[model samples]
Target: TQLLEQSPQFLSIQEGENLTVYCNSSSVFSSLQWYRQEPGEGPVLLVTVVTGGEVKKLKRLTFQFGDARKDSSLHITAAQTGDTGLYLCADLTTSGTYKYIFGTGTRLKVLA
Candidate 1:
Protein backbone atom coordinates (compact mmCIF):
# COMPACT_ATOMS: atom_id res chain seq x y z
CA THR A 1 0.00 0.00 0.00
CA GLN A 2 1.16 3.50 -0.75
CA LEU A 3 0.98 5.96 2.09
CA LEU A 4 2.09 9.48 2.86
CA GLU A 5 2.79 10.72 6.35
CA GLN A 6 2.68 14.36 7.37
CA SER A 7 4.06 16.01 10.46
CA PRO A 8 2.64 18.53 12.89
CA GLN A 9 -0.94 17.33 12.41
CA PHE A 10 -2.06 20.64 13.87
CA LEU A 11 -0.51 24.07 14.15
CA SER A 12 -1.54 27.40 15.58
CA ILE A 13 0.46 30.57 15.21
CA GLN A 14 0.23 34.33 15.48
CA GLU A 15 0.14 36.38 12.32
CA GLY A 16 3.49 36.91 10.62
CA GLU A 17 4.98 33.67 11.96
CA ASN A 18 6.77 31.12 9.84
CA LEU A 19 5.96 27.41 9.68
CA THR A 20 6.86 24.30 7.76
CA VAL A 21 5.01 21.05 6.99
CA TYR A 22 6.49 17.82 5.69
CA CYS A 23 5.20 14.80 3.79
CA ASN A 24 7.05 11.52 3.48
CA SER A 25 6.57 8.10 1.94
CA SER A 26 8.46 4.88 1.38
CA SER A 27 7.40 4.58 -2.25
CA VAL A 28 8.42 6.75 -5.15
CA PHE A 29 5.89 8.87 -6.97
CA SER A 30 5.74 10.23 -10.49
CA SER A 31 4.32 13.49 -9.25
CA LEU A 32 3.26 15.22 -6.08
CA GLN A 33 0.87 18.07 -5.40
CA TRP A 34 0.15 20.36 -2.49
CA TYR A 35 -3.27 21.75 -1.69
CA ARG A 36 -4.88 24.09 0.80
CA GLN A 37 -8.53 23.79 1.71
CA GLU A 38 -10.80 26.32 3.32
CA PRO A 39 -13.82 25.50 5.47
CA GLY A 40 -16.59 23.83 3.47
CA GLU A 41 -14.60 24.12 0.26
CA GLY A 42 -12.54 21.66 -1.74
CA PRO A 43 -8.78 21.96 -1.75
CA VAL A 44 -7.24 24.41 -4.17
CA LEU A 45 -3.98 23.46 -5.81
CA LEU A 46 -1.09 25.35 -4.27
CA VAL A 47 1.65 23.93 -6.46
CA THR A 48 2.89 20.80 -8.21
CA VAL A 49 6.59 20.00 -8.38
CA VAL A 50 7.32 17.09 -10.68
CA THR A 51 11.08 17.29 -10.85
CA GLY A 52 13.23 16.10 -8.01
CA GLY A 53 14.73 18.88 -5.90
CA GLU A 54 12.36 21.34 -7.57
CA VAL A 55 10.99 24.31 -5.69
CA LYS A 56 8.03 26.53 -6.46
CA LYS A 57 6.85 29.59 -4.61
CA LEU A 58 3.40 31.08 -4.46
CA LYS A 59 3.59 34.42 -2.74
CA ARG A 60 4.59 33.56 0.81
CA LEU A 61 4.19 29.82 0.42
CA THR A 62 7.02 27.66 -0.85
CA PHE A 63 6.83 24.03 -1.96
CA GLN A 64 9.63 21.54 -2.58
CA PHE A 65 9.78 18.04 -3.97
CA GLY A 66 12.35 15.66 -2.56
CA ASP A 67 15.21 14.51 -4.75
CA ALA A 68 14.00 10.95 -4.41
CA ARG A 69 10.40 11.77 -5.30
CA LYS A 70 9.28 10.16 -2.05
CA ASP A 71 8.74 13.31 -0.03
CA SER A 72 7.79 16.95 -0.13
CA SER A 73 7.66 20.05 2.04
CA LEU A 74 5.74 23.26 2.37
CA HIS A 75 7.03 26.41 4.01
CA ILE A 76 5.15 29.57 4.78
CA THR A 77 6.91 32.83 5.47
CA ALA A 78 5.24 35.58 7.44
CA ALA A 79 2.00 33.69 7.61
CA GLN A 80 -1.25 35.56 7.94
CA THR A 81 -4.73 34.69 9.21
CA GLY A 82 -5.72 34.16 5.61
CA ASP A 83 -3.24 31.31 5.45
CA THR A 84 -5.21 29.28 7.96
CA GLY A 85 -6.59 26.09 6.51
CA LEU A 86 -6.09 22.37 6.01
CA TYR A 87 -2.96 21.53 4.03
CA LEU A 88 -2.71 18.24 2.21
CA CYS A 89 -0.15 16.46 0.07
CA ALA A 90 -1.02 13.84 -2.52
CA ASP A 91 0.76 11.48 -4.85
CA LEU A 92 -0.63 9.48 -7.73
CA THR A 93 -0.01 5.76 -7.65
CA THR A 94 -0.78 2.65 -9.69
CA SER A 95 -0.91 -0.08 -7.11
CA GLY A 96 -3.63 -2.40 -8.46
CA THR A 97 -5.76 0.67 -9.10
CA TYR A 98 -4.60 4.05 -10.28
CA LYS A 99 -5.36 6.53 -7.53
CA TYR A 100 -3.97 9.20 -5.30
CA ILE A 101 -2.68 8.72 -1.79
CA PHE A 102 -3.20 11.67 0.51
CA GLY A 103 -1.23 12.49 3.58
CA THR A 104 -2.77 12.75 7.01
CA GLY A 105 -3.85 16.32 6.60
CA THR A 106 -2.35 19.22 8.54
CA ARG A 107 -4.61 21.86 10.02
CA LEU A 108 -3.13 25.32 10.36
CA LYS A 109 -4.58 28.21 12.32
CA VAL A 110 -3.10 31.66 12.10
CA LEU A 111 -4.42 34.09 14.69
CA ALA A 112 -4.84 37.72 13.90
Candidate 2:
Protein backbone atom coordinates (compact mmCIF):
# COMPACT_ATOMS: atom_id res chain seq x y z
CA THR A 1 0.00 0.00 0.00
CA GLN A 2 1.19 3.49 -0.79
CA LEU A 3 0.58 6.23 1.70
CA LEU A 4 1.75 9.80 2.05
CA GLU A 5 2.41 11.15 5.51
CA GLN A 6 2.81 14.83 6.19
CA SER A 7 5.00 15.94 9.05
CA PRO A 8 4.20 18.64 11.59
CA GLN A 9 0.59 17.68 10.94
CA PHE A 10 -0.58 20.83 12.63
CA LEU A 11 1.05 24.23 12.58
CA SER A 12 0.27 27.63 14.02
CA ILE A 13 2.35 30.51 12.80
CA GLN A 14 2.19 34.27 12.97
CA GLU A 15 1.81 36.47 9.95
CA GLY A 16 4.97 37.18 7.94
CA GLU A 17 6.61 33.96 9.13
CA ASN A 18 7.79 31.30 6.68
CA LEU A 19 7.19 27.60 7.06
CA THR A 20 7.77 24.33 5.28
CA VAL A 21 5.57 21.25 5.20
CA TYR A 22 6.69 17.81 4.05
CA CYS A 23 5.01 14.89 2.34
CA ASN A 24 6.66 11.50 2.12
CA SER A 25 5.81 8.05 0.85
CA SER A 26 7.37 4.65 0.80
CA SER A 27 6.73 4.18 -2.93
CA VAL A 28 7.71 6.34 -5.88
CA PHE A 29 5.02 8.81 -6.91
CA SER A 30 3.40 8.92 -10.31
CA SER A 31 2.39 12.56 -10.11
CA LEU A 32 3.28 14.58 -7.08
CA GLN A 33 0.60 17.17 -6.51
CA TRP A 34 -0.20 19.66 -3.77
CA TYR A 35 -3.55 21.01 -2.64
CA ARG A 36 -5.20 23.33 -0.14
CA GLN A 37 -8.69 23.22 1.27
CA GLU A 38 -10.57 25.84 3.17
CA PRO A 39 -13.39 25.08 5.54
CA GLY A 40 -16.55 23.74 3.88
CA GLU A 41 -14.78 23.58 0.51
CA GLY A 42 -13.13 20.94 -1.63
CA PRO A 43 -9.43 20.63 -2.01
CA VAL A 44 -7.96 23.01 -4.55
CA LEU A 45 -5.13 21.85 -6.80
CA LEU A 46 -2.15 24.04 -6.15
CA VAL A 47 0.51 22.39 -8.28
CA THR A 48 1.61 19.20 -9.94
CA VAL A 49 5.38 18.73 -9.90
CA VAL A 50 6.38 15.87 -12.20
CA THR A 51 10.14 16.17 -12.36
CA GLY A 52 12.55 15.31 -9.62
CA GLY A 53 14.17 18.32 -7.93
CA GLU A 54 11.59 20.56 -9.57
CA VAL A 55 10.47 23.67 -7.74
CA LYS A 56 7.39 25.71 -8.50
CA LYS A 57 6.33 28.97 -6.92
CA LEU A 58 2.84 30.41 -6.83
CA LYS A 59 2.89 33.75 -5.11
CA ARG A 60 4.34 33.16 -1.66
CA LEU A 61 3.86 29.41 -1.87
CA THR A 62 6.65 27.15 -3.13
CA PHE A 63 6.23 23.52 -4.06
CA GLN A 64 9.12 21.14 -4.59
CA PHE A 65 9.36 17.54 -5.72
CA GLY A 66 12.02 15.31 -4.27
CA ASP A 67 14.99 14.16 -6.33
CA ALA A 68 14.14 10.56 -5.44
CA ARG A 69 10.45 11.01 -6.33
CA LYS A 70 9.39 9.64 -2.96
CA ASP A 71 8.84 12.94 -1.24
CA SER A 72 7.65 16.50 -1.68
CA SER A 73 7.58 19.78 0.21
CA LEU A 74 5.56 22.99 0.41
CA HIS A 75 7.02 26.23 1.63
CA ILE A 76 4.98 29.26 2.42
CA THR A 77 6.69 32.62 2.80
CA ALA A 78 5.22 35.54 4.68
CA ALA A 79 2.13 33.68 5.64
CA GLN A 80 -1.07 35.55 6.29
CA THR A 81 -4.26 34.61 8.10
CA GLY A 82 -5.86 34.17 4.71
CA ASP A 83 -3.39 31.34 4.07
CA THR A 84 -4.91 29.26 6.84
CA GLY A 85 -6.25 26.00 5.52
CA LEU A 86 -5.74 22.26 5.26
CA TYR A 87 -2.72 21.49 3.11
CA LEU A 88 -2.51 18.18 1.33
CA CYS A 89 -0.27 16.17 -1.02
CA ALA A 90 -1.65 13.66 -3.44
CA ASP A 91 -0.85 11.39 -6.39
CA LEU A 92 -2.74 9.55 -9.06
CA THR A 93 -3.27 5.84 -8.73
CA THR A 94 -1.38 3.53 -11.08
CA SER A 95 -4.41 1.28 -11.38
CA GLY A 96 -5.76 3.35 -14.28
CA THR A 97 -8.77 4.45 -12.30
CA TYR A 98 -7.52 8.01 -12.14
CA LYS A 99 -8.19 7.90 -8.42
CA TYR A 100 -6.14 10.06 -6.12
CA ILE A 101 -4.23 8.90 -3.09
CA PHE A 102 -4.10 11.70 -0.57
CA GLY A 103 -2.02 12.36 2.49
CA THR A 104 -3.47 12.71 5.94
CA GLY A 105 -2.97 16.44 5.49
CA THR A 106 -1.50 19.29 7.50
CA ARG A 107 -3.75 21.83 9.10
CA LEU A 108 -2.16 25.26 9.12
CA LYS A 109 -3.40 28.22 11.09
CA VAL A 110 -1.82 31.50 10.17
CA LEU A 111 -2.55 34.21 12.70
CA ALA A 112 -2.79 37.82 11.78
Candidate 3:
Protein backbone atom coordinates (compact mmCIF):
# COMPACT_ATOMS: atom_id res chain seq x y z
CA THR A 1 0.00 0.00 0.00
CA GLN A 2 0.99 3.62 -0.51
CA LEU A 3 2.46 5.15 2.60
CA LEU A 4 2.03 8.81 1.83
CA GLU A 5 -0.20 10.91 4.07
CA GLN A 6 -1.86 14.26 3.37
CA SER A 7 -3.17 16.77 5.86
CA PRO A 8 -6.24 19.03 5.70
CA GLN A 9 -8.76 16.49 4.49
CA PHE A 10 -10.95 19.40 3.36
CA LEU A 11 -10.49 23.12 2.88
CA SER A 12 -12.64 26.07 1.89
CA ILE A 13 -11.32 29.55 1.23
CA GLN A 14 -12.00 32.82 -0.54
CA GLU A 15 -10.82 33.42 -4.03
CA GLY A 16 -7.86 35.50 -2.94
CA GLU A 17 -6.93 33.40 0.03
CA ASN A 18 -3.75 31.45 0.56
CA LEU A 19 -3.49 27.82 1.64
CA THR A 20 -1.00 25.08 2.23
CA VAL A 21 -1.29 21.30 1.96
CA TYR A 22 1.14 18.78 3.39
CA CYS A 23 2.12 15.26 2.46
CA ASN A 24 4.22 13.04 4.72
CA SER A 25 5.41 9.46 4.95
CA SER A 26 7.65 7.27 7.05
CA SER A 27 9.16 5.66 3.96
CA VAL A 28 11.53 7.56 1.74
CA PHE A 29 10.68 7.93 -1.92
CA SER A 30 12.92 8.20 -4.94
CA SER A 31 10.58 10.75 -6.47
CA LEU A 32 7.42 12.55 -5.55
CA GLN A 33 4.71 14.10 -7.71
CA TRP A 34 1.73 16.37 -7.12
CA TYR A 35 -1.51 16.28 -9.07
CA ARG A 36 -4.83 18.09 -9.19
CA GLN A 37 -8.04 16.25 -9.98
CA GLU A 38 -11.23 17.90 -11.09
CA PRO A 39 -14.64 16.34 -10.97
CA GLY A 40 -15.25 13.52 -13.44
CA GLU A 41 -11.66 13.53 -14.63
CA GLY A 42 -8.32 11.95 -13.79
CA PRO A 43 -5.59 13.77 -11.99
CA VAL A 44 -3.27 16.10 -13.84
CA LEU A 45 0.38 16.28 -12.83
CA LEU A 46 1.40 19.57 -11.29
CA VAL A 47 5.02 19.09 -10.30
CA THR A 48 7.62 16.43 -9.61
CA VAL A 49 10.42 16.54 -7.04
CA VAL A 50 13.23 14.03 -7.33
CA THR A 51 15.90 15.36 -5.02
CA GLY A 52 15.75 16.03 -1.34
CA GLY A 53 15.25 19.66 -0.27
CA GLU A 54 14.01 20.47 -3.73
CA VAL A 55 11.53 23.24 -4.40
CA LYS A 56 9.57 23.93 -7.54
CA LYS A 57 7.12 26.66 -8.40
CA LEU A 58 4.38 26.98 -10.95
CA LYS A 59 2.87 30.44 -11.11
CA ARG A 60 1.35 31.00 -7.68
CA LEU A 61 1.93 27.45 -6.46
CA THR A 62 5.04 26.29 -4.65
CA PHE A 63 6.03 22.69 -3.97
CA GLN A 64 8.79 21.50 -1.68
CA PHE A 65 10.35 18.22 -0.73
CA GLY A 66 11.81 17.62 2.71
CA ASP A 67 15.47 17.00 3.31
CA ALA A 68 14.71 13.39 4.20
CA ARG A 69 12.63 12.84 1.07
CA LYS A 70 9.78 11.55 3.18
CA ASP A 71 7.66 14.67 3.27
CA SER A 72 6.42 17.35 0.90
CA SER A 73 4.21 20.41 0.81
CA LEU A 74 2.20 22.53 -1.57
CA HIS A 75 1.49 26.19 -1.01
CA ILE A 76 -0.89 28.26 -3.06
CA THR A 77 -0.86 32.03 -3.12
CA ALA A 78 -3.94 34.02 -4.03
CA ALA A 79 -6.03 30.97 -4.66
CA GLN A 80 -8.76 31.13 -7.28
CA THR A 81 -11.97 29.24 -7.75
CA GLY A 82 -10.27 27.40 -10.55
CA ASP A 83 -8.06 25.77 -7.95
CA THR A 84 -10.97 23.90 -6.45
CA GLY A 85 -10.38 20.17 -6.64
CA LEU A 86 -8.64 17.25 -5.00
CA TYR A 87 -4.91 17.69 -4.58
CA LEU A 88 -2.96 14.46 -4.42
CA CYS A 89 0.66 13.63 -3.74
CA ALA A 90 2.21 10.48 -5.10
CA ASP A 91 5.36 8.49 -4.50
CA LEU A 92 7.23 6.78 -7.30
CA THR A 93 8.31 3.36 -6.15
CA THR A 94 10.86 0.90 -7.47
CA SER A 95 8.25 -1.66 -8.47
CA GLY A 96 9.46 -1.34 -12.10
CA THR A 97 5.94 -0.70 -13.36
CA TYR A 98 6.08 3.02 -12.72
CA LYS A 99 3.31 2.62 -10.22
CA TYR A 100 2.14 5.56 -8.15
CA ILE A 101 0.72 5.39 -4.69
CA PHE A 102 -1.30 8.51 -3.97
CA GLY A 103 -1.68 10.39 -0.74
CA THR A 104 -4.88 10.63 1.27
CA GLY A 105 -5.82 13.67 -0.80
CA THR A 106 -6.83 17.22 0.10
CA ARG A 107 -10.15 18.41 -1.18
CA LEU A 108 -10.07 22.16 -1.70
CA LYS A 109 -12.84 24.56 -2.53
CA VAL A 110 -12.20 28.17 -3.43
CA LEU A 111 -15.23 30.39 -3.21
CA ALA A 112 -15.68 33.30 -5.53
Better of 1 and 3 by TM-score: 1
User: Superposing every Cα of model 2 onto the true structure, what RMSD results?
Assistant: 0.9
lDDT of each: 0.91, 0.93, 0.93
* lDDT accuracy of residue 20 in candidate 1: 96
On TM-score, the leading prediction is 2
1-112 per-residue lDDT for model 2 (tens digits): 7889998899999999999999998799999899999999999999998999999999999998899999999999999999999999998878757888999999999988
Rank candidates, TM-score, best first. 2, 1, 3
Off by over 4 Å in 1: none
lDDT score of model 1?
0.91
Cα error, residue 51 of model 2, in Å, equals 0.6
| Reference-based TM-score of each model | 0.95, 0.96, 0.94
lDDT of 1 by residue, 60-89 (tens): 998988899888899999999999999999
lDDT of 3 at 17: 91
Error of 3 at 51 (Å): 0.9
TM-score winner, 2 or 3? 2
